[model samples]
Target: MSDVFERYERQYCELSSNLSRKCTAAAALNGEQKKQMISIVKTGIDEAESLIRKMDLEARSLQPNVKAVLLAKLREYKSDLNNVKTEVKRLSSGGNYLSARDDLLESGMADTLTASNDQKARLMMSTERLNHTGDRIKESRKTMLETEELGVSILQDLHQQRQSLLHAHNTLHGVDDNIGRSKRILTSMSRRMNRNKWIIGFIIAILIIAIALILYFKLK
Candidate 1:
């Protein structure tokens, strides 16, 4: 258990340390900075997934609800990171100058100042959202760690609950399969019985007609 905890801790530390470096590098305006940010976000996601996997393995009984919440948070971070990348690309493409043209006009710069102001506002908003996303990621990580700690206390309860749920699910699945099979069998049996009934009626009608014909010929 200590080994598992140590591994998780080491991965978390490595991820956090790298994140700090990436953030510093991203403060600069260069292609390298953008690349670093992308790499960092990817690494963060990988580390989070690794942590979750480790928790699952060690716990032997992780709460599905908790896992679901953590996964949702991770997805939110991924979306936010993608949005940040998009904003960076737009600014780098000179779209910012086009967007703040109104602000530029007030400064006798025709459209440039207005466009710059609008772009700045957008950039500020994007930055805020990015920061918020970072905070959320941090909170999620903390929650995950806390859950791991609590797992020791709740292992027996969680194990029993998980087993009960699994058994219920399996039983329901089996019942559904049996019901389907029974329906098919009944349908096939009905068809066969109906066909045989028709065949028997036809044979009886033919035999009666033959007897009538013989009686008519004998009377003649």
Candidate 2:
């Protein structure tokens, strides 16, 4: 049972580390960055699910109290990953880029895009929440380091660990929201910049046409 617990604990730590990486990536990722994040998330989810299945089997063979705590923690991790999956799907849908370059040009999208920087500020706040959660998880792990027993005390320790996991779960959700908002703002800004480029090009073309007309009339 101790061996199985050790194995499960290692796997759980790996999953948590992967989740933190994903959250960090999501906070700063652009469209291409998002693709990279998606890959990381997918790999992490697959590994976590596999570990969870093994944990379930091992749990069935172990003592009830130990098995119960481990199973509960595993379920929480699974739920957090599933939430991340949903967020990834929403991000990949590209619904946020509804306003094209032409639309931006016609609608003064630069101003609109500039105004959305507030969302960036909000995202920064969300990153703070993630950082706080990471700190909490580290603190919680420190308590486990001092533990010398594996009886009922282990159950209480696991409960504290679960609370730390919940913090991580909440942090990930905050990251997902921030990422979605940031993606929309970025896509809008890109479209606005493209529109400005087109406008400048058109102005240059008009100037060239005016020069040509002037030369023709003067020579005639």
Candidate 3:
């Protein structure tokens, strides 16, 4: 679902960008060139409309929270598309208006009106470009923040793993210490048992000698 949405969304952005560039190019063109650009713009508008429909359909099929976000984005994109269409229509009309007024070129008022219209068109184009730049900046900031959050989460996971490893290392050291102590205690016990055996053998030898001496004296 998300993949489809992103595909359509990416295509729409590209289409819109193409249309914007064509529109800007139209401003500097005339005669056959301008006519061809206008044709391209019309076709792009149709493609844009189709993409919008696909996006809207995918958005509606999504979960409530996600759907809401997509719908809002769709609404904004629709407005931007409308703005592009309006600008194209304005350009076409401006061209026709200039041609129609060719006969009145000698009139001062006609010249002033023409200059004013041209200035207004340029101003509108500048404003549109400015708005697009602002939107791009906002998107960049959002991406940066999301990246930072992911980085922080990864760091937290690493810290927890490090702590667990440290605990295991300490436990092993303690076990080694206990094993050494137990070995020393067993060695001390073995030495005491050997000394007791020697004492018992010496006492038995003295008893045998005294018994023999008493027997000999009785016989004599």
Candidate 4:
């Protein structure tokens, strides 16, 4: 367990540093390199987060001292994951700027040098705004899809839970019926036993009276 936690911690630390460096160098990165770096960081972040979550679960059953250490490691990994996520977001947002810059520089328009500062500034601003808007629209669509999937999953889980509860309720109801039948049977048997006891007592009383009368006649 300790080894596992240590490994995850080391991996997270390494990924965090790599992502930070990548973000710092993002302005110099070409489109392909940026995409590759983003992919690496995203994958590493997911792995690190998963490892920490596993560590959390394993720590629950460990001794106090070991559990504390594991928990601390988990926190460190989580922090690193957050840092990596921030770097990724930075890179993603900068991607549009990089693309627009590349487009403008590669256009080789002869008038670009003669263009006024105000005109260039306006063009740059318009390009960036359009890119950012497009990115936001894509993100919104992604979020909507994810939310719909989550809702479906929740409904399925609720349906399963309801089925389980209904089954349990039916089982308890059957048990109650069995108990009622047993109680009725017991009451009927008890009444029959009491009636039989009374009949036996009356027969014994009559037998005793007859014997007493015969004995008294012989003596007189």
Candidate 5:
């Protein structure tokens, strides 16, 4: 269950990154170039929706309202994307108008020139903001991946240590068994030595008795 959650979280993060990258690229592009990124952005958004639903199912306590809000926001983003696409198409089809407007703006005598410059500045600022946001998200993702890798390394090391301790425990048990066997052998040997000493003493006593008997007989 934890593994499933982890996988879902990873997928959500990856989709978020893909969406951010696509948005950043879209911000800097216009016309066909920007249009080309829309499908990729939509794919990321769809994947994110699926991931969130999976997460919500896993966490029963999760509020459905929150998911609804997220889906609503994604819909808004999609709407905005369509509007931008339409605007790009319109601008691309009006190339002659754009060139004429640029010439007039260069002449520096039209009131529309200032508004155009302002709009361009705003677009540039928006692009920069998107790029900055994408960079931060990318950095955060990289850090997360690194932390996960470190955690895995630590777990592997701990497992190896545990195995080593188990092996050492088994070895100690074997050594203890050998020591017990040696002790039993030593005890048996000690008992045999004691019996041999008693038998030798009895034989010596018998020899002395025999010598005494011989002396008495000779005297008789």
Candidate 6:
């Protein structure tokens, strides 16, 4: 990163020095020389602008304090470059100063820079979209994991309930068996009590009859 900044700074310094020299000499030159000077100025300004852009990009990756210093430096470079461009325009202000070719070249350089900036903008937008998509996918994955855990918990509860129901059913079956056994025992006891009662009544009536016959004999 520092290397990139150094390269841009170096280029910016060279372009600035070269433009100032050419602009200083531009007033004394003849028509062709002045045109050449203007041409050099145009090219230097373009290169300087390019370097400033590179430096600006490098600044973006820097620490905030360092980035601020670099940005301030870049702004100064831009201002100087703009001044050079204005000087060139002043020198070439007359009618029919620049040829159609120079105009075409300048326009082409501008178009290229604009296209590059647009491409970078598009790339940034695409990266942001990809980030959003990744975030959503992560959230969806988390939701799916939570849902899976919930499902497992529900299944576990169902299994526990089923076990409890099976245990209850077994207990009820045992209780039913005990109740049936108790009913049978009670029925047997009732039958035995009824038989004993009948036997006792028969024995009592026989005693009474025997006693009456003895009384009649005594009377006779």
TM-score, one value per model? 0.36, 0.39, 0.46, 0.49, 0.47, 0.43
Q: Give one digit per residue, the lDDT tens place, for model 3 in 2-109.
A: 899999999999999999999999989876688789889989998898788778767766688998999999999999999998898788767655544542343335
lDDT per residue for candidate 1 within 1-220, as digits (tens), equals: 3456457646655665565555545546445456556566556756655664554445444357655654454455445445544444443333333333333345453477776776677667756666687689779978986886576458767768889999999999999999999999999999999999999999999999999999999999
RMSD of 6: 27.1
Per-residue lDDT of model 6, residues 138-187, tens digit only: 69968975875576567657766887999999999999999999999999
lDDT of 3: 0.81
Clash count, candidate 6: 0
| lDDT of candidates 1 onward, in order | 0.62, 0.67, 0.81, 0.72, 0.63, 0.74
Model 3, residue 18: displacement in angstroms? 0.9
Off by over 4 Å in 4: 1-30, 43-80, 115-127, 134-202, 205-220
TM-score between candidate 4 and the true structure = 0.49
Model 1 residue 7 CA deviation in Å: 5.0
Better of 2 and 4 by lDDT: 4
Candidates 3 and 6 compared: the better one by TM-score is 3
The sequence of per-residue lDDT tens digits that candidate 5 reaches over residues 1-220 is 3456567767776666666666766667655566567656656665675665555444432246654654564455445445544543343334433444454445553568786776566556655665687589669968975875576567657766887999999999999999999999999999999999999999999999999999999999
Candidate whose lDDT is highest:
3
- Among residues 3 or more apart in sequence or in different chains, the pairs in candidate 2 whose N, CA or C atoms overlap within 3 Å are none
Clash count for each candidate, listed in order shown = 10, 0, 0, 0, 0, 0
Model 6: weakest 10-residue lDDT segment is 95-104
- Model 6: lDDT of residue 41: 77
**Residue-wise lDDT of candidate 2 within 1-220, one digit each (tens)?**
5687678768777786777678566756765566678677767766775666666556645678887887787688777767766765565444223222223344333466663564455445545665687589668856653542243356666766887999999999999999999999999999999999999999999999999999999999
Name the best candidate (by TM-score).
Answer: 4
lDDT of 4: 0.72
Question: Which regions of candidate 3 fall more than 4 Å away from where they truly are?
Answer: 101-220
Model 4 is weakest, by summed lDDT over 10 consecutive residues, at: 110-119
Which scores higher on lDDT, 1 or 5? 5
